[model samples]
Target: MFRQSLPAGIGRMMASMLGDSPPSSRQGADAFPSSQSFHTTATLAAIPDPYKVLGVDRNASAGDIKKAYYGLAKKYHPDTNKDPNAKEKFAEAQSAYELLSDAKKRETYDRFGSAAFDQNGGFDPNAAAGGNPFAGAGGFHGFGGGFPGGFAADINFEDLFGAFTGGARRAGRGRRGPFQEVLVGEDIEVQTNISFMEAAKGTSKDVVITPLTECGTCKGDGLKAGAKRSQCRQCNGSGTRVHFMQGGFQVAATCDACGGAGMIVPRGSECGTCRGNGVVRDKKTITVDIPGGVEDGMRLRVAGEGDAPPTGTQAAPGTRTQRGDLYVSIRVAPDHRFSRSGSDILYTASIPLTTALLGGEVTIPTLDGEVKVKVATGTGTGDRITLSGMGMKKLGGRSRGYTPTGDLKVEFKVAMPKYLTANQRTILEVLADEMNDKTARRTMNIGKDSPPSEAGNAPTDSQKNEGFLKSAWHKLMNATKNGDGGNSASNPSKKESDDAKKSDKESK
Candidate 1:
């Protein structure tokens, strides 16, 4: 009777071991009172250590634990294994895995045994009586006689099964969820070089890109001509496979055969154009408007110009798939004559020495055009001339009703003549003599002790007839002979006195 109730494979193995003729039904009934009584007795037995249940040591690593769980789950799955107690053993292994996989839970189980998770003092037969409808009756309740709150609740059975089944998660249908909305096409980055003037002012450019699009031959269905579609055998047209876990929970995973589409075509029935991929690479052209005041290395975002999303990855039911943005990195060529500092432009202008000394108008190049700037008479090298509103436009400063602009600073570089002609040299010499004579007379006047003759005081005849150049020259010559380089020419020497007296006598 026990052999009859056992799975065919298990029954054969047991019969071979204990002989063909086993105990009769009446004898078996006498040994075990009822199925419920037997289940309760088995569940109340001492719980096995989690490490032993998973077939690992106490110091096993997390990877080891995971490997052992996958091996045991595959071997004891109710769908594959025919053993009558296979479901119960699988539940025990799953429970062990759930506890040992978590660092905190594992530590608690190791320190306090299974009692750490038990709300009650010990195993309670009443708790098992409150059976899980999903597991059906007579299901084995292992640790603590029931499921722990944080143990099986936190385990994602789909992920655990998918690890062995090699499956993917299917996109849910309906209004776009947060996770679905974030599944946009990838953004693209490209680099382009532009002229300096183009970067200073705005310009437009046409960019060519090859983005993925739905195939025209298969109409994004990934089917060849004359090929018929049929429901997927793996998922039974639902596009997902449900796996029943030990704790009365179910998990759905994407069907691997049809890739969650719930349909499939026979081999060699795929469309030749897209090779059953549903998407193809196509060329697209988009115009990008680069704004003014954009600096080098600045990225410009062009919306909906990048690669398109893969087929069947649309957002909401009514909305179409969103294309990612295109980021264009700008590289500005260097200008020989102009350099920038913020919004201001710096330019070096060369001016003749004569033009610098004598005030004149100088022509300077600006972004607008060449303009004449007035140079001061005493302008020197390294002098800067600022022209208002002739520089780059302000980036974000134009909203206050006044369009602000930066100044164009022109730095002067005095260009002195390296070679002078004969006639020029002669003229310069004469000019130099005249300047020296004027300077000597100014020096003499500055050395006078008295301030000046008063209006009422008339000048004497001797003062009026005084020869300033003669007196200055005689004083200078006398001071030079006396080795008194530091002496002033205000006082006359002995020789000057004798010469003056003789000149006066001769005149009389």
Candidate 2:
């Protein structure tokens, strides 16, 4: 509990956190506590010491301290790492390293035994309390298992040699004292609701959030109303009570239950107004500015104005830092008729078969307004009519209009008549007859462009004669012969008649 090291600074440290106390110096190197029998604690018997944390010797040079600190820092600096507890370990290492790295303080710690700096032990150098911004009578020590002390190995070697350059040199003076107050707000989360139109179009609203606030009785300070905080008699001003086991052979460290702080606070009893808890409870109302076109489950962040900081002056629990961000989750309702497709919108439309065949104009729906769509005759069902720039907005971008929208993908479904009158049937019949007659005449009359061998083309006389002779030959060949096997009257013998004529002509 000595070092509840947090991510921020001292003002908000619960029981005293993230703070810096600078050192005030005396004239020359003579001011150093380097002499023996003064501030040094290394040779002391039996106690597990802080030197093991930074891993340097009792007489390690300033350069050595620098080298040790850098190496450990690389292994634990939370900023350069992903380990969950790296920040705390790094802070601990830093505190130890900072104290040892100072040549003057290191000398003072070396000369005067650690007990010499103790308030009740006679020679109070105010040494530990002096420029060590982190010191307050007593705080955290690694004995509690917070972080391993000697894990870093990347320290600048020059530091091990006690060089005066780099971060090894000693400072003459620095700032130190009780600091003023700066309370940060608490962290919180919230949820919001919106309509589909609002989600698509956009809107803003106010939300009220309730979280654990400060305690008002103590006026934000954890003291009995009108009471003051006092130092713990058990631990004295040093803040921690020392235990001597086996008659002081082995010494142990423990926190003072009375002080609650490692050292002293106000005095006698807590502030009556707050009853020791430094804060009070209250509700916060915030105006949330929602950007347009936010989809469902989208989040919005509202800064500050979250839960109030808890109150207490002791060093027990950690204090709050900056007010947590507010997250607004968006919920968009779904539309019944329209379906979104990225930058395109889809919908269905119906039309009469006659209208589809004859061509006509159809009215289509759009975001801006409705417009008549041109239906080219012979347009197939599902013929799409893209009304450009009419669609859903692109989620993340800078655009004045909706994200490349599209409109009216009207799919035409042909509608035919279910019932017909007598006159209608008659007209259909007549139309069918006329079409058939036209097709027959066209088939019979071949144009001049028709190929010569086509059957429908104009017929010549020789062709007609050949066709007739072929028909006659088929008819005669099928006739029955007379009983005498001479001739059938129906079938003519032209070759015989020709022979007789030739004989008469020869006789003449």
Clashes of each: 0, 77
23: Cα error in model 2, Å: 45
Per-residue lDDT of candidate 2, residues 60-129 (tens digit): 7778878888888998864455576775566557756655665654555566534333322123444344
Off by over 4 Å in 1: 1-182, 218-221, 224-269, 312-320, 397-404, 423-508
Model 1 RMSD in angstroms: 21.5
Q: Give the Cα error of residue 375 in candidate 1, in Å.
A: 0.9
- Model 1 pairs in collision: none
Model 2: ten consecutive residues of lowest lDDT: 171-180
User: Estimated TM-score per prediction?
Assistant: 0.46, 0.40
TM for candidate 1 is 0.46
Q: How does residue 493 of candidate 2 score in lDDT?
A: 75
lDDT of 2 at 89: 62
Q: 342-365 in candidate 1: lDDT tens per residue? A: 778899999988789887998888
Candidate 2's displacement at residue 438, Å, is 18
RMSD (Cα, Å) for all candidates, in order, is 21.5, 22.5
